[model samples]
Each structure stands twice: as structure tokens, then as C-alpha cells.
Target: MITEQAPGKLYIAGEYGVLEPDCPAILVAVNQFIRVSITKTNSAAGIIHSRQYSQDSIHWVRRGFKMVIDNRDNPFEYILAAISYTERFCLEQHVKMKLYDLHINSDLDSSDGKKYGLGSSAAVTVATVKAILRFYNVPFSNELVYKLSAISHYSVQGNGSAGDIAASVYGGWIAYQTFDKNWLKQELNHKTLSEVVSEAWPGLKIQLLTPPVGLNLMIGWSQQPASTSRLVDETNANKAALNGEYQQFIDFSRQCVLEMINGFENKDIHLIQKQIRVNRQLLRHFARINQIAIEIPRLSKLINIAESCGGAAKTSGAGNGDCGIVIADAQTDVTALEQEWRQNGIMPLDLHVHQSKIKQ
Candidate 1:
């Protein structure tokens, strides 16, 4: 059996702005992960299993170079897409395929099956692609894995800046600028998967960051799950009507994120925390102009408490609800803060940053 895992991610800054090409966002890979394991099977058909789904198992068969599944409303859509794209790349590299039972397990969700807003879908896609490639004994790099996984994810979801995918593949603190989706979509129409993966994608950049010496990150779950895609789509629909406000928000967000990146490089925790506050305010203005609630009531309370404790806090991701992140000095004791959060109906997560095992 071959196994692989990918870490979940949280957006630290540059929320709405990152959707635009060349706009930068800061994110961190958390310890939570999605694991995918592949085992060779003697049966003619392969099985895919996950406890998250209601079905016992989904059976699939290879029919003339395509995988056919029995279920139409399949919950393993991302996994299946990853398999299909990885097989295409394998074909290009002259790798033989075989029947295998693929199993998936996730730590990015709650015990009761609620997402912690940790980017589980992106992690699962990266894990599935990595597992299949490892199973085939194929020589690959992290960039190759990211490209294949991104293609698979984009093919299915059809939106977002893909910062989560980058964080999952790279597995650390990262500064990411989204690639031009229009260019990628056009390239996909005429280029092979291998060829496209080798090309320099326009506006795409991923830089691993070094955390400051005394930086401490904390996560608080609001217990309310959110749909990132739905919020993004709603924001996009309202962008045109906002006139110059949308562009202003993008410009401010870019500046805030850039300064935050500088803080990381200079090991200035104060500057980083200040920018976190700036980013939060920018998102507030963004919400006002777009007429969307990026920070709900619970998230507002969460941030207020963190700030009262001398930490910088902000709503993570699209953030109608889900989790809020806090950055504090390592010397500070957060026991009281955690206790206060619990009292306010928030669950403080004991998640740490996940460093990448893959060498750049």
C-alpha cells in the first residue's frame, strides 16, 4: 500500500483581493490533514471508501481508459477528478496503471463531520494525486503534484484563487499570487497535461515564508460552517456594482499583505500583528461596499476577545462563519484567553503550523 497526506490551510491575509490575478495572499498550513492510501486489489473493480460519506463504498471500473462509477451524485468528486488527471499524466509519462482500492480519511473536520474551515477539499485533492503517483513509483516534484492537483481541483470547482491548494502542496507559511485563470483555461484546451505543467503560468507565484522567532498563532472555531464558494460567487456578482470601491479594497489589501510579508522577512512580530489589524479593517470596508457579511456576529466577538488579550485577530477565509485566527507573542500566556473563548461558546483549536517535508 502507498500512502500520502496533505495539510489543511488558513488564509492569514489578502482575502477578497487574492481572487484577482497577481494579487497576493498569506496563508499557513496547519497540522490537520487529509490522508489517502492506495492498495493493489485483485478484484476487477476498485473501491473508494471514506467515513465522511453515507455510502459504504463506491465501486469503479476502468472502461477504455476512463473510470466509470455507479453513483451519479458522488461525494468523492474531487478524489475522482484527481485520479483521472493523475492517470492522464501517467499515460504521458508511460506509466502503467492497475486496479487499486483507494481509502481517504480526514482530520480537517470535526468528529461530528463539520468542517473547521481548514481547506479540506484542497488537501484531499493533493493527497489523492500524491498517493496515486507514489503508488505508480513515478518520479515527481512538489510543483508537479501541485500543478496536477490544481488542474483537477479547478476542473471541478471552477473558482477561487487556489491559495489553499498551494499551502497544502507546499505545507508551510506561504505568500501566494494567483495565476491568470483565463490563460490557464485557454492553455488547457490545446496543451497536454505534462506540457502545461512545465510551462511558466502567468501571474502565479508561491514563496515560502519564515515565521518570526517569537510568533505564536492560535485558532478559534466559531462552530458555524460556511460555504466559501457561495460567498465568493455572491461577492463577484456584487463587484461590478460597487464602482471604484472594489478596486480600492484590492489596492489596500495588496499593500497590507505586502507589509505583512515584509514583517515576516524582518522577523518583526509587531508589524505583522499591526498588518493583521489593517487587513481586518480592510475586510470590513470590503464587506460594507460589497454588502456581504464577511465577518458575522460570532466572528466579531471572537476577534474582539483576542484583541483584548493583546493578540491580533481576524476572520479567516471567506468568513461568513467558521474560524478566526489570532497571532500573539510567544511569551504571553493564552490560558486565560482560551478559557474566555470557551465561555463565549468558541472552541479554541490546538493547531500548529505544519512544515513541509518536500524540499524546495
Candidate 2:
């Protein structure tokens, strides 16, 4: 049996800017993870099961030149995609593989199984790809696994920045630069999955980051799941409705990111504080332009409490819901703030910064 797991992630900064195809975003892997376990099976067919998915096992078999999956709408779509891509990559390289049963599980959600928007799909994709590669004894770099996982994720999700995928693969603080989607889309028009995996991704870039010394970090969940894609769609629609408006927003977002990165690296506390607040305002501007309620009531309350405690809080992901990160000084009364959050039905996750990436 072979088992692998990858951690979920949160973006510290640079959420929307990374979508520009070549911008860098800072993010971190959290302690919660999605775990995938694989064991050899005597039967010709293999089964895929997930605790978070349906109870029944999904049956699959490899034909002479293709992998045939029985269920197309299985909850483990990303996992299945990972399997297919890895299998295809092996076939392209002429590597032999064996049949196995794969079981998937995760800790990125609550006891009742509600997601906290910790990028579960990305974690699942990374874990599945890693497990599949090892099942066939394929030599892999974490970078390769990341590229493979991003390919799989993009195939299903379409036009994602893959920051979540990067975080899952690397398992640490990262100032990640998104790959060129235009180039990728063009390449996909002519290249096979195997060729894409093996070819040198000329313009792809990634870098690990370190937070400033003595930085205090906190995360709060609104318990409201936001549809990241829907918010993205709304923002995109607004951007398209007005010419040059998107560029203006992009300019602000880019500056916000620059200040954030430089501020953290230079250990400039005031700069960091200013940028955090500036970014939050820009995010609010984005929501207003798109006419979407990104800052839900709970999140607004969270921001108020954190600000009252001498910190800054904002929507962390695609906005509208999910988690909000609170940046505060060490002396901030986090205990009291947490009590207030609980009173308001918000959950504070005690997730520490992850300094490691994927592990054996």
C-alpha cells in the first residue's frame, strides 16, 4: 500500500493579482490536509473511494490505450483527473503501472464536514498525483508533481492561478508566480499531457517566502462558504463591462501586492499595516464594482473586532465568504477577540505557519 497526504492552504496576500498570468502571490500551507492511500488489488479493475465522497467505490479499468472511468460525476473528480493524467503521462513515457484501490480523506473541514475554504481540491489533487506517481515507481520532483497537479486542476476548474496547488505541493510560505495561462492554453491546443509534463515550462516561476521577524498571524472563518468561481465570474464580468476600468483595478491590486511583499521582506511594520488596510479597501472596491457582497456580515464583524484589537482583517480568498485573516501585533488580545468571534458565530482556526512542503 502507498499513502500520501498534502496540506490545505491560505493566501496571505495577492489573491486576485495572481490571475494576471504572471503576477506573484504570497500564500502558506496550513496543518489541515487531504490524505490519499493506495493499495494493490488482485482484481483486474481498480476502485476509488473517498470518505468525503459517496460510500460506493468507483470502478475503473485501463483499456489498451485509454483509462475508462465508470463514474464521470463522482465527488472525487479531481482525484480521478489526477489518476487519468498520471496514467497518461506514464503511457506517454512507456512506464508500466499496476492496479490499486485508492482511498481519500481530509481534515480541512469541520466535524460536520463543512469546508472552511482551505483549498481542499488543490490538496486532494496534489496528494492524488503524488500517490499515483509513486504507485508506478515514477521518479518525480516536487515541481513535477506540482505541474502535474496544476494541469489536472486546471483541466477541471479552468483558468485557476494554481496557488493552492503550489502550496499543497511545496508545503510552506510561498511567494508564487502564476504561469501564463495564455501560453498554457495555446500549448494544450497541440500538446499531449505527457509532453506538457516533460517539456521545460519556459516561463513558469515559483519562490518560497519568509514572513518578517516577530510577525503575528491569525485566521478567522466566517463559516459561510463562498463560491470563488462565482465571485471571479462576477469580477470578470464587471471588468469586461467597462474598458480600462479593469486596468485601473489591476494597477491598484498590483501596487497593493508590491507594498505587501516589500513591506514584509524589509520588516517595515507601518508599511505592512498600511498595505494590509489598503488591500482590504481595494478588495471592497472590487466588490462594489462587481456589485457582489464579498464581505459578508460575519466577516464585517470579524474585521471590526480585529481592528478594534489593533489588527487588520479582510476576506482571504475569493471573498463573499469563507475565511478572513487577521494581522495583528503580538500584544493584541487574541483571546478576547476569539471570544467575541465565538459570540458572533465565527470560528477562529489556530493554524500556525507551515515551514515545510510535501514530505515522504
- List candidate 1 stretches off by more than 4 Å: 55-75, 330-333
lDDT of 2 by residue, 217-236 (tens): 78999988765665665666
Q: How well is each residue in 32-126 modelled by candidate 1, as lDDT tens digits?
A: 98999999999989999998754425556687999976331243888999999999999999998899999999898898887899998799899
Alpha carbon deviation, residue 272, candidate 1 (Å): 0.4
Number of clashes found in candidate 2: 4
Least lDDT summed over 10 consecutive residues: which range in candidate 1? 68-77
TM-score of each: 0.93, 0.90
Model 1 score (lDDT)? 0.90
